[model samples]
Target: MPDIDDFLRNQERIITTRGWAVTHVLPTDDDPDTTAPFAYTVGLTAHDHPELIIAGLPPLVAHTLLNDLARQVYDKAERFSHGQRISDLIAGYDAVIIDGRPTDDLLPGAAIARYGRLRIRLQQIVWPDQQGRFPWDSGYNFDPHIQPMIAHL
Candidate 1:
């Protein structure tokens, strides 16, 4: 099984190589260096699930990237989970949070003319103790309002 540190290091490398700026800290309120086209703030939740905040990209791009990143993490967890069960991997952490909002929306009362925002929650699948089995089903659900933004990626 791979260590969490190695997994996270690979994740950071992937994000950087894909041209996304990964930051442990959010930009300070007083700082005025908003030149990056895309930014992702990533941190672990209290229960160990990854919480990701993505900004500056269009809604579709953000959604695609979110899915890609989550898949990457899930893949890593699958390798570490006993019996290669996705359910076991998910059971080890909290819900994965992907919060994607338009950069312009950060402005007070700013009206976004295009691309709706999305906050997706991916929860782990659970089973009854007696009926529990491997190959657990898991998926993500997004706000219905963002349906128009989803397309083949």
Candidate 2:
């Protein structure tokens, strides 16, 4: 929401030249204290794949992770589906892939602009807390708002 025209323009150039683009979004007014910062991709859907989304990470961290994941999806044709646990994405703790909704406030303007405001489906790369406990796990110590719960596909 913070004058993302420049961001979108930059992303458009990246996608046009490199065949894909990754965008990181910091926490904004629309994102309350309970919601964590998130990052997303804008090109996988065009390859018959769902765009990737990750929460509870800093902009740079999420951007780096999304680039690796996007490469897997785009270059290697790797596809992430619901309930799949992936250990290679993050160190120590594993991540689960789950369905995510494309709410206007949660996803950035870059995504909306890239896909013409359509309801873009998202697949969340849900990482676990330090104790290896996911949000739905009992005794999870991390703040619930740090990662919004996925509604499932």
Candidate 2: 10-residue stretch with minimal lDDT: 103-112
16 in model 2: Cα distance from truth in Å? 1.8
Model 2 Cα displacement at 87 (Å)?
Answer: 1.0
Query: Could you give candidate 2's per-residue lDDT for residues 1-153 as a string of tens digits?
Result: 647678767877888876678777675687566456888888776777788888888888888888888888888998888889999988887988987667643665566676755657788888888899888888988877777755542
For residue 142, what is the lDDT in candidate 2? 85
What candidate 1 gets wrong by more than 4 Å, as runs, is 1-47, 78-153
RMSD of each: 15.5, 2.8
Clashing pairs in 1: none
lDDT of 1 by residue, 31-117 (tens): 545432233323222124333333444545555554555455543542122122233222343222222333342321111111112
- Score every model by TM-score: 0.23, 0.85
